[model samples]
Target: MSNKKEQLFDIGLFKRLFQFIKPYNLVFSGVFGSVILIAILGVSTPYLLQQAIDTNLTNRVSEGFLFFILLMVGLLFAEFVFQLLFIYYSGWLGQSVVKDIRVKLFNHLLRFKMKYYDNSSVGVLITRSVTDMERIADIFGQGLFMIFRDFLTMIVVSIVMVIMSWKLSLIVFAMLPVVLYATKVFQKYMKTAFEEVRNEVSNLNSFVQERITGMKILQLFAREDVENENFKTINGRHKKGWLKTIWYNSIFFPIPDFCASAVTGLVVWYGGLASVVDGTATQGVLFAFVMFIPKLFRPLRQIADKFNALQMGMVAANRVFKVIDTTSQIDDTGKHIAKNFKGDINFENVFFNYVEDEAVLKGISFNVKAGETVAIVGATGAGKSTIINLLNRFYEIKSGVISIDNFDIKEVTLHSLRSQIAVVLQDVFLFADTILNNITLNNPEITEAQVEQAARDIGVHDFISSLPNGYHYNVKERGVMLSSGQRQLISFLRAYVTNPSILVLDEATSSVDSYSEQLIQNATDKITKGRTSIVIAHRLATIKKADKIIVMDAGNIMEQGTHEELLQIKNGYYKNLYEVQFLKEEVA
Candidate 1:
């Protein structure tokens, strides 16, 4: 969504981009050397042709003719060699810079806090990483270095033309001011058009990504026609954005072609007349001037086109830098390594809110001893999941403290802290990978034997063995190949294999079949044994055997005790919720 229009030649942006190329100094130096050699050699061809015509061809001398012909051929071959080297090195430099940039950008995204992602569009991020990065690479591969070579060629040609005849050079120079003015206008208009193009591209990407992700919802509601109509509108805007650039190109590119032709005609007409009138211009000089004029104006024309790549690259860099400059990272100032936490968790009057001025957990406090199983039952939006988020430090607490084993959670390294805990949620996510890889998550230290043993211990080994490939079975994207209950069982095994010191089950068994529920209950018993476990479930029946039960209503703890002790409270929140919610679920 960054709409900042960067200048055509932004020094700051280029400086940052060049840092990525610092490691490839040798390759870039080779490119620079090739450009210079090509420029010097490119001018030699026309000059050598002029010499051949004036000295050898006109006099009908065979010796000089053969020598000049061989000399021109050698110069042409050298120029070809350098041109090839320039192309190869420039492409190598561009690709190398892009590779480093992509790695850095991805790493930056990985460190961003969860809140940053909550407020960002995934499609826009993808555009910046993939499409925009390509634009930046084009600036180097096809724009900057080539522009340098072309401009250098023009400069060399100009100096030689002036030396040959100052009067003819003046005529060519007269057309320049007009061409330069037109180029300025073209760059101005094209920059604006390219910026709009990039913006529309991001918009189109965002729309398509959302539609694809939510296709099931659209189908379920039978809104395909409506969605398609909306897509057409976005797709149309994207088309218009690109068409605008083409319009400017059609107008601007022709002006330079016209100038090149006019200069060539003027040189031929005026120089030809001068030769007949006073013998001031030679036939060889006129011929060389005609050729050199186009060479000089050609780069000027191409620069106008190359400016598109330059401007687009700067705009893309601006957006990319914005992401890299974002300051939304979780504070990991804690030096505690948590090598041996005792699993005791304490929330001392902790407060939190996902949105400003709307408290989700208002002065909530709780405690769970090591090796205790605590069940938290609450209605929807009663902050059941918020507690789990807070314990894992996914979101920083607004006030008060959350600690494990008397060590403040914030005063510990995130890796060390989260390494000791695992959470299994109701809506489990599985990657498109083999069952063994999904369970072990490709951890080299966690062997196949270890995963199989953990699966066996968790009582899901028989269920997995029933599959086509057993542990090696491929679970397609989001585990769409498996049932919801089967996905939950996979998640349970994944969590259990890690051997987390503290376990969290956030409504893990609330949406499973009766048969899968039995399997999950059995696995839950094994995983939660001798660990501090926090179970968040709406089903009251599942928490009957928990060491302690905490009933929450509207962000406040209504009751906390054993199941029987809480039931003894007359007309308590837990008693009513248990009667109304659990009874209906049982009857169903």
Candidate 2:
């Protein structure tokens, strides 16, 4: 959807992509050597035929006729060898380039700040990383190099024709302007068409991805018919975008093809006049001209198609580079390391927002002493989760200072800072993988025995062992095979196994049944003991014993005290919130 200013052929795109080939110069040279050798061989084969006919057969010298046939066969065989080299090497280079670029792009995505992802679509990024990358590969394998081969063939063949008979060659050359004009127009239109098609593909991918992910909601509301209609409209636009390129191809291809045929016919008429009527040409030369004209012009039609490919590749590269070139990564210029990181934390006058002038946290200030458990209780939009996000440096604070163990968080490497903390959110996500793998997250240091120990430590070992295949049970995509509570338990097990110095439980018990909640409560008791803990308590009754409790509403802290201390205040915010929750529990 970006206005990247795609050209019929982008020299900058080529130059940029060409750098990927530099790492595999040997393979690239094979393609280069093949193209040149094949070009030379193309001219040689036809030239051999002209020699055999004019020198031997016409002169009635049959001594080396078989030798000429053998030589031509050898030239063809050599051309076959280089053609094989061209295919194998070009294909190898294309895949290698795409692999490198995909890895680089994904790694760049890893470093991007959460703000970029907060505003971007996952489906569009996937299309750029997966689909557009494949198109870029074609630019190397089938698009540019093949076009180069055919072009060199045409150029060499045309020159040979001109040298052989300038008059006949000039007549054939006259048709060239028409073919070039058609190709230019086709390329111009195809660039626009391909760009539109790529845009539609991105839209379709985003739409389908979001719909499928929320298919539960769609069917729950019985909106299938409405969504289906939406799909048809998007798909129709994609079809029309492709049809525009087809329309150009249909009109463009025949022009070069017609020119080839027309030039051949003109060669026959003109060759006859020069050779027979005026004695300016020979039968052998006439035969050579017949062979040369098609070679000179047919590739123009194919170039139009390859140019289409080059344009598509350039368009994809532009989109991909936009992401690769994004400057949204968190600053990692910290010269300090969080040596033996303690969980002591402080925030001074922090001001933040996801959008301009729409602050989510306004000059909020709080602190947690090392090894103490502090609970933050708030309504849905009271900025509980954003605090933890800022703690992890997931987003930058607009105006604030946050420190851990008296060292400013920004003065530590992200890895060093984040390594000391573990978080379990209200919603849990797991990969389509083994239960044990999900728990350890494929950490080589955490063995199956260690995972079992951690699970037992958290009191969820029985639940996991009860499942079929025990530790090896595959959770399936996003842990769909497990119930929501079961997934949350796995998340607990994951966080526990890390043995983090700081632990954050973000409304972790809000969605589970009583039994699951009890199990989580038990895990929470074990994980929080002697560790610095921050709990976003949705159920006010759950945090009575905390060392300190903070109540927040509308991005500001309304109350802060121990449970009994806050209750002693007359009509305090915490007392009212606690009373409301206690009444709700009594009614239920």
Candidate 3:
């Protein structure tokens, strides 16, 4: 979200980018050495041509002509070799640096709290990690080293021109100020233009990603036409963003070309008059200066084009660094290592809010003994699920203390804390991988036999075996290949394999067929046998066997007791909720 526009030549940004290249100093050094060699060889070629014309051809020296031609061929071969080295090594360095940065960015993302993700766009993050990283690499491969090589070539050629014929070189140099001034203006415009293009690209990515993810809703409501029109509008903006860059190029490129031509003309005229007047200027010198004019302006033109890449790289680096610099990660300041937790959860005077002054859990307090089945029932947005989030430390409480087994939850390592707890959410997510991999999550310690045993215990073994590949069947992305019920079953198995000390089920069986509901109920009963379990349910009948029922309404615990005991209260919250669900079941 920190999409600030940066200066074109941000020294701070370059300095940070160079840090990734520290490990590959040897490769980068080789690339720099190759550029220097290529520049020297590049300037030598035109000078060799001047020698051929003056010493070999003019005097009609046969042996000297052959020797000069051979020397020119050798120089060309050497330039080719150095150019190849420069290209290959620069590419290698760029790729290596990007690989390191991509990994670092991903690791940083892993540390961010859930709240950070709640406020961020998935599309923009994707662009920063993928597309932006590519642009940063281009700084080295296409922009940085190439620009250095071209600039050095120009300097070497300019110095040689002055030494050969200072008068002609002066004529050529006279037009440079105009071209340089034009280049400066062009670069400034391109910077703004490229930044707009990058922003549009991120927007387009986000729109498409959201649409595809919600395709079901769009089709259910028959909103395809409306969505398409919206897409066209976004697509138009993206196109316009790119056209701005093209427009600037059209206006800037011709100026350098014209200046180069005019300087060539001036050099020819002045050299021709001088050669005739005193025979001081020679054909060799004039021709070499003509060649040198393009060499000087060619890179100027290219630097103008390559500046686009450079600007883009700087913009990308800014965005990427912004994400890297974010400090909104879950504070893992706890040094305690949780071992064999008794699952005695306690929430003391807890107060929390997702946003300021909008409390979701108002001075809430609760306790669950070890190996107790605690079912929390409430209406939607009544803070039932919020308790689960707090218990898992996904969000820090605004004020309160959460403890397990008399130890503050925040005083333990996140890995140790989370490893002892498992949660099965309402909406299960499965990766595009095999059923076995999804179940065990590729845990090397959890063997295939154990996964199968857990699956059989949950009565899903037969269903999995009915498929062609049994446990090896691919579920595809988000488990689209499987039914919702089947996906839920897979989730149950995934959690069961972990064998955590505490288990949480948040409306896990609310939306499913009777068959799947039955399977999930049986799986639930088997998994929650001895471990401390907390179930948030909409169906009151499903939790009738719970040891304790905590009825929540408007972020407060209105009633807490066994199902029978709570139903006995006069017009109690749990009693009314139970009767309403019972009536609905009777009607169905």
Candidate 4:
């Protein structure tokens, strides 16, 4: 019962949905005009046929026969015109609404906090923004408006059937109870089926997207047969969900069809009896009711199908609206606009976690003066990356004061805050585009020559220029065509071109070959000079020349000093980590 209540037309939900239609009032007017004309013509067809037979054919008069034929022809042509207008307008309206919704949903997603993405599935988001959006459009195309036309036609036909002959009308409507009962049962089951199908689609999509993205891992580990079996399980569930809906459809449709036939036969028998015995029914009235039977039950059966679409649309809309209504956003309430930064940064008593009660960073404190270089060395999951994410305001801290140049970071606009910092990550990501476009990120203000100069400044100019198309060379999706080292080299150019006030190198040379690592090392030294720099490093070579070194373990600052200063401490965390990790690298 609760599920059924949810599928009922929530006035507020539809009111919001219909707001998309309000923009195209002219098309809406055309659809409404078409529906009314179609209804009038629907009843007129049967009445005209009965009139022609009773009046013109019964009198055996040729005089009025041609007029009836011409009138019928006129009615059909008008029906065609209205139907063409109806299809054109309704289809146009549906497409237009979905297009707007798709854009709005995408833009909304862009503002969400990184924390939201940390917990969300890319495939589920894709389903909501793409697949579900298409379903919502059908509410206008084949769901709501079509059902309205059906109901309107049914109501008009019902009135006329009664006015012509109540006895015949009563006989025809006797099947309504049985048909309505079947439809109620079908709708109850179909709604659950469609909901399950939608869930399965999201699961299937997420599975495929994750597997495809990790294809390298999949093949390297030789997990093909295992993944294929898992895929079959997911795909089987998707098929079963759709089949459940089909099973109900198979049972439900025949009920209406059988009821229509039964009602027609019963109407004819009663009409024949009335005409012969009571003299209250005419042959014309009986013939009109027979014609009206199909018109009536046809819409009834079609309404059942449209209800299925409406159920799906409503389910999709609820999901979409729920996402849009989520308040997980990095508040950009500060009005301050920043053109550049002096690069002084401070973090005091910062605490953060990706999950509740599972702290990833705890009471971390650090400071970097303008144009100073600070290197952070720690094992993976030591909170090195969390500091970088916090500096850019990617996630909100539980309790902290993070400031740049004496201004609270939270009191600054996100664009202004992020624009000043540039990072080159260990696992570099490049879009499928020309090197120059990926570097500039389509910013029209950064000319190609500026990028070239930045590339030369970082000592990677020769490598980029040697590429097939130099700066114009397309990297393809995620820079798959390039070696891992080459992708990181490109990322160096990307970070350097911006000439950021603060520079971050997140284990930048960790995975590179000797040649690319040397090039990246040179790029780092060239870019980090006279800038506020934070280096998260595994290689001793990356941290040897830092003005200050902060060693972290389990989110706490364990030691702070220069290269030689920290090594002399007895039983220090940095000393143990260096002996265990970096000492071997230097020897190699």
For model 3, residues 119-230, the per-residue Cα lDDT tens digits are 9989999999999999998899989999999899989988999999988888888888998899999988888888899999999999999899999999999999999999
Q: Clashing pairs in model 1?
A: none
Model 2 Cα RMSD, Å? 1.8
Sorted on TM-score, best first, the list reads 3, 2, 1, 4
The lDDT for every candidate, in the order shown, is 0.87, 0.87, 0.89, 0.88
Off by over 4 Å in 3: 1-6, 586-588
Across 178-223, the per-residue lDDT of candidate 1 in tens digits comes to 9899899888888888889999999999999988988999999999
The runs of at least 3 residues in candidate 1 whose Cα sits more than 4 Å from the true structure, single-residue gaps closed, are: 1-6, 584-588
**CA lDDT, candidate 2, residue 250:** 87
Candidate that beats the other on TM-score, 1 or 3, i.e. the better one: 3
Where is model 2 more than 4 Å wrong at Cα? 1-7, 586-588
Highest-lDDT candidate:
3
Cα lDDT tens digits, model 4, 1-588, are 575365555667788888888889988988887888898898898898888877877667677878888998999998888888887788789889889888888989998988899899999999999999989988878888888888899999999999998878888888888888888888888888888999999999999999999999999999999999999999999999999999999999988899999998888898889888997887778888899999999888999999999889888887898888888889898777778898998999999998889998889888999998999988778999989988888898999899999889988899988888999887788999999999999999899999999988888899999999899999999999898889988888888888899999886666668999898888888998889999997779878989889998888888899988999999988888889988998899
TM-score of 1: 0.97
